[model samples]
Target: MIRSFAVAAIMAAIMAAIAAPVAAGPIEDAIAGSWRKPADKARDQYRHPAQTLKFLGVKPGQTVVEVSPGGGWYTEILAPAMKGNGKYVAGLANPLASVNAAKSVENFKTKYADKAIYGDIGIGTFGKGVADIVEPGSADVVLTFRNVHNWHMSGWDQEAFNAFFKALKPGGTLGVVEHRLPEGRPDADMKKSGYMKVSYVKMLAEKAGFKLAGSSEVNANPKDTKDYADGVWTLPPTFAKGDVDRAKFAAIGESDRMTLKFVKPK
Candidate 1:
């Protein structure tokens, strides 16, 4: 009995020792400082800047890729955050909406003007008909925000997920943020409303051979009805229908979104 207890104690001590330092890395500090400037206006509807990235487990020196980086909101932050010791790549869709795509590239370029610090990071475009843009097992992290639902609507969700999985190195991370619908909801409702069921996200990740790491509520918005007359976009963020009723839209704010973290198993 004494020998058995001693063996177990030593194993526990080793495990704790191994995990202690990684828990205190500079990644947390970088994430904490992601958005230190103006906090309102166009940036208000975004997911909690620092907290969301931290939950996604972004490290300073890792190769990270953001897909369909529209307008470069997150791209502006990501490039600087991964500067010096890391690589940042934005994989955009080929032939993006003319105005939006051009603006995205321009904004990203302007954000990382100091090449010495940010390294050689540029926007990579993949054609629309192709499924994945990333090289198999090349990146340490693959991220996307509000892009999966559109993939689902376009019947390319499976291909997209597969590409994401292939792009990550073994044990790499995939961070996702999407408008959320409640779990177990019927497909009909999901089809009409842009919000997606969490179960579907989990299932897709699993199908792509990823293990669900965890999830977060950093982006949750309680006022979301998830049943807007014009769908999720009817809420504050997009408010597609302008001049309809500003106050009602203002009250709803942004749609509740599921923030997920998945790991490509080694």
Candidate 2:
């Protein structure tokens, strides 16, 4: 009996020690805590915050920016998450993205009041079609989720990628999550299917003077078939098919996504 009791005590001590080293700090707490009961239902369709932020390497006392914070999905979590020491900025696309920016700002303020910080999410048109908002080298990390395909469709992939690279401080991290296509797919496939070629994304980042840090399967969907007929939009989160074949898609869940972390050169 005594030996069993001692073993249990030792196990408890080891667990606590492991947890202590990686305990979520103020920023992480604020970010994760924002998803309370009411919001939990919707979060299932959103990117998993724990996995996404972990891959982004979000830490307390750092400055982070979320690009095109559509519908304030991530903004709702990032504001209070960085309250005590870190700062959270929502960098929306310029005049084109004003409607999105205003909506995000209002939602964030209602959720966090002034505890969360914000910057000029509105920037006028720049060379060609680039946004001239966020300042250069102003952030520690910039994250964009599931928005790259839209940019590619609009022919602003390189422009947006370069903007992210220029806006971060030397050695700042850029985290990208996009619907992914299988290797060797045609460029035409990207347009039909939401999945982008991983090589294309890497080359774009490298050309922007950023280094590939790492990648994760946190959001990968194995069932994705990478076909032209019904690309990523065929999946649940998008469900472009809408009751056409609900059961088949319900089994597939979300689109297969690539989660990559890149860093701007120092």
Candidate 3:
């Protein structure tokens, strides 16, 4: 039987649609999964998880260590993405440093105990004077998200970088996402404010013998002028000021960030 010409065309179009493959792969699928907390998913607009990870050369089957996963923001994504294929290790905080640090390590384990969701996430230590977050030269990638400022504040940012370098295999990658302070800002602000200059971050990596491979603006936010009284926390999420110019800060969204990729020398 001969069908109408328009009906044939419509059927052809339907076939084409069914055959076309989805461009987003496992990384994107993991980010969209329902297992992640709603609050964490909402921050994707500012975090740009998939894009940043892609730019950093993350792939399945490679060991990746997430340094000092404060509250596991990236953990939700990294753990699931690496499940069954790669190693996902959390470089835990230094309990010897403070009482809270000890509790943080314990809380992270409990929070991510559901293997059905997080997989087998190994644990290790990362802090001042103690940086072996994994077996030396074991990880293929070492990712630190917005935690550099904390080490800088604690006067051990270099130690953290040295540890990252030690953990990664030769030729491995180190992906860093951090709130950015403008270069014009005084160096002292890096300690007090929750931000670091891109140059300063690069210097730390270089000093640790890692070469800067590339950088991405995937997480950049121009709305952040980087002069908030409460630092990056003045924006949404933290709102450190607590209702002071709340609407204004909300409009600004998250802080501007610099995403960098460095490589440990072979």
Candidate 4:
């Protein structure tokens, strides 16, 4: 009897071990879902969406707010991932305030009009105020990608961080993915260029009452030299030069990016 019990216990342990990865299937399936466009899929190599989301500890059933989900790039992935069990809030710039912002919001609405996939998705306006976009202490995870530089350029970086802090509950996570400048790059340069120094971003977040929880290099591209004619816009996806050495920029792939995670203290 004892021998049989030992064998059964070991078998159960092995099965549980195997089930661990299987249990993570929902997130992986959502990423690979048919709803994604071919172009979006092609960028996965540089974006590292799966690994980045995993690193951010994003899971189903959690309320997630994506700040400035411009063009709904991440929205396409996040909405499906949170489809049945979780909630996704796309906090956009107030469309009423800017023509460009209006276009972005309209595009997002058109993209996710399908109730079967994105009916539960919420819309909020940010960039002007905290409560205007997301409710205070309501989000489990707040994410922003490649947007801090714009905020800094507009002299709203501190306010943006403070808004993020207010939106997240105590112990909530903030995930940031931004084009990275070399360590010694000046703050003034970041205002004009899209790339930002990781240290500066961290300092701003700290000032907004967030603790630097961790950072990941999953999106880093070492080949990028950070001296492009148009800064980060010189890289692929933007190629602001308009076919000027397009192949050269393509070969370099995307800009080196810093993936940072910050947490509001309980």
How well does each candidate superpose onto the true structure, as a TM-score? 0.77, 0.78, 0.91, 0.90
C-alpha local distance difference test of each model: 0.78, 0.73, 0.90, 0.89
* Residue-level lDDT tens digits of model 2 in 68-121: 666676665666666666777776544344776456555544554544343222
**What is the per-residue lDDT of model 4 for residues 1-266, given as tens digits with 9 covering 90 to 100?**
99999999999999989878655556787778788889889999999999999999998999999998887888888888888888999998788888988988888888798978665889988975545467789999999988998888887889989888889999999999999988787767887778999999999999999999999999999999998768889888988999889999999999899999999999
Scanning candidate 2 in windows of ten residues, the lowest lDDT window is: 119-128
TM-score of model number 1: 0.77
Relative to the unseen true structure, what is the C-alpha lDDT of residue 61 in candidate 3, on a scale of 0 to 100? 91
Instruction: Assess candidate 4 and give its TM-score to the true structure.
Output: 0.90
Ranking under lDDT, best-scoring first? 3, 4, 1, 2
Better of 1 and 2 by TM-score: 2
Residues 1-266 of candidate 3 have per-residue lDDT tens digits of: 35788899999999999999968666777899898889889999999888899999998898999887888888888898888889899998777889999999889999999998788998988877895888999999999998899889978889889989989999999999999998998999998889999999999999999999999888889889888777888898999999889999989999899999999889
lDDT of 1 by residue, 126-236 (tens): 434655566667899999998878878877787788888888999999999999987766876666678888899888899999999999999998887786678888876
lDDT of 4: 0.89
For candidate 1, give the lDDT.
0.78
Q: Best by TM-score, which number?
A: 3
